[model samples]
Target: MFVGIIVDIISAINMFTGQVIPARRWMEPFLLHNQSILGSVFYVITYGGRCIQGATATILSFCRVCAVCFPIFYQKLGQPKYIYTMQVLQLFGGGVALVLLWKDEYEYILEDNGLYSVGSDETNADWFYMFVAIMEVFFVVVIVLNNLVTYTMFRLKFNKKNAMKNNGVSPISSQTNQEKQKRESGLDKMTFIVCLVELIYFAYIVYSLQINPYMNKRIFYFFYNILCVIYSTFSAWMLLIVSKPINTELKRMFLIIGGKRLTRSISISVQGSRDNHK
Candidate 1:
């Protein structure tokens, strides 16, 4: 997630600087024009980072599904070192893409009706996009499978947990177990949303890029926002929403502050009333 966020940030910079700012011509200090150093860098980060994020997201969804369907094996394979190694390999894959495109010419090439696109020259462009598209589609497929597995496991566990409760198990154990199950269910639901959103967003992105490769600059920039910043923003908020611990902590903090202010107000009111009475 952290890596995704960083990639999104760089992509946003590329989008606005390379495309949006130039289109609007609003206080344009610099332009990421064709065959420029900055343009090359933007292409590298935008494409390469996309590959990185796509691959990692698929891995993440797989991990979650594994946790649900094969908890024992998931635990065995879920060590920090192992996960880190996998992440590094994913980065390496992206790095390869980056290296390939590092020297490739980037251009705000002209589109139909005098519009410009934030992309590379014809050379290596076709296969590069195909590579990114493949990873994105692979991620969608994997996440869909993961979603099915997670939903099945969640439903089964939910039914079993409810049955135990209805059977009048020990009150304390039942409550404790129920709470645990609730947390698990919440996580599963979160995973469901994550997978569903991934399916939707990636499908939209891929479809849009394919069907309409040439468009007005503003429209393209809007799509860029959807591709990176907006998606990341949604993920962040959804994470906060699904995180019980974070929600609880935030609620506690708010309560503490509210209580203090209420108590102080009451004390002030009481003192004023007494003074008026006396």
Candidate 2:
């Protein structure tokens, strides 16, 4: 929630600097011509939430896969310094992207004229597009590698379970073995879902920005909104489901509450018994 709030604040600053500030100075040329306040609010809420949620989801999934793939190294990754370093890198990268994107209204150029055809201006735009392409490729590669590692872990766990079962381990003694298999299966399914979603998002974005030159901005906006909302909701739901610690904490809370109620009832009954005896 804190991360999401920070993302929202950052995005709000970006919007204010881009639109509201420019509007105040009568610099209408810098504002998005088609942007209404309603549209802006909708875009910010959806996209801002999506950015934070997506990053959190991806990191959580990566950590799970990492734990299975490299159990020995997982603890090291959780060091405060390392986690802080990662956060700083994420913020820095986002800041750079925003600066580059907002420098001279590059989005307006793309929105109006579609993909650049040819010329110095077109060449510069192409450079930016290619940069985005390279980053997308890198991201997709990481996702693929993560999926592979997780699936390998799943197979290893399955084989281990089979071996244990063949050795006639008691079911009670092997409860953890069974649970591990379930966890692997769930993680495998999650990997597939995440990869599929990422592929679809990349395909849509590439098509909107590069392939379909004649596509309307409204259509692009519609797809972008749908894509982001799906990503955000699915990402959050998956984490909530897969995170055993979260479930355990919830269970612990309930148990504490139940225990207190039982204790109170027992005390009241004891007092009533003493009174009757008296």
Candidate 3:
């Protein structure tokens, strides 16, 4: 959720900029205009978020797959040492990308879709497109493979249950197993929704910036902007929808807060009424 919030905030900046660019309702915000600090900052944030979020999702799926298919290494990966190492790596790598991208001021020329590194070399335009393409393709391949394997495992479990029933044997499920299954099911749904939304974002980026570069720029840019806003939000909302625990917690929290406020207001009103009467 932390990562999601930060990514959404940065993406919102670009979305806001994109909105202004078209309607010309007001002048461009100084921070986000072309070749400005915000322009480069947005690039690093978006690109880093894009790559890191996808990688994070993949790592989670990979961990689940390890739990199912490779229990030996799963334990190792879940260890505090290993987990901490991975977290450090993500931060370190993201920092590295920040440095590489911001080598000089003009390295990242923030245009409509936020993918051009137009600094000192014209040929690098195509390079940025290719880089984005390559990163997205890597994520897509890993995500699809992990999902397919998970689906296959689920089917096998279903078949085995059917076979046991047919053979006049009852398959026992422990409370622990049931709980784990429920959690996994929620996670599967959440990951699937997030991945689907992200894929749509990636596909449009590739198409507009790479595949069909000559398309109507303004219209495409506007649509991309809309997508940025959508991608920023869809994950967190989907989590609340798919995960009963989180949804319930949020509801309970809000209800408690509202009830307290209402009770306080009622007490204040009653005191005022008593004072007037006296």
- Top of the candidates by lDDT: 1
Candidate rank order under lDDT: 1, 3, 2
Q: Which lDDT tens digits does candidate 3 get at residues 138-225?
A: 7777777887788678657656755655676533544444555676678778767766876787788789877797676457756866
Residue 197 accuracy (lDDT) in model 3: 70
lDDT of 1: 0.69
Q: Tens digits of per-residue lDDT for model 1 on 1-278?
A: 67767766666677666555546654333443333665667667766766776666777777777787888978876688877877785686568677677767655544442334344555477667677777778878877887778778878877897788788888898888877776776777677776766776677667656666545656655666665765556556766787787789889999999999999999999999999999
Name the best candidate (by TM-score). Answer: 1
Q: Over all chains combined, what TM-score does candidate 2 have?
A: 0.65
How well does each candidate superpose onto the true structure, as a TM-score? 0.78, 0.65, 0.74
User: What is residue 49's positional error in candidate 2, in angstroms?
Assistant: 8.7
What are the runs in model 2 whose C-alpha is more than 4 Å off? Answer: 1-62, 106-126, 241-278
39-123, model 2: which lDDT tens digit per residue? Answer: 3343334333334444544565677787887788788887998788656644543443444333322223333333211222445
Candidate 2: deviation at residue 27, Å? 17
TM-score order of candidates, top first: 1, 3, 2
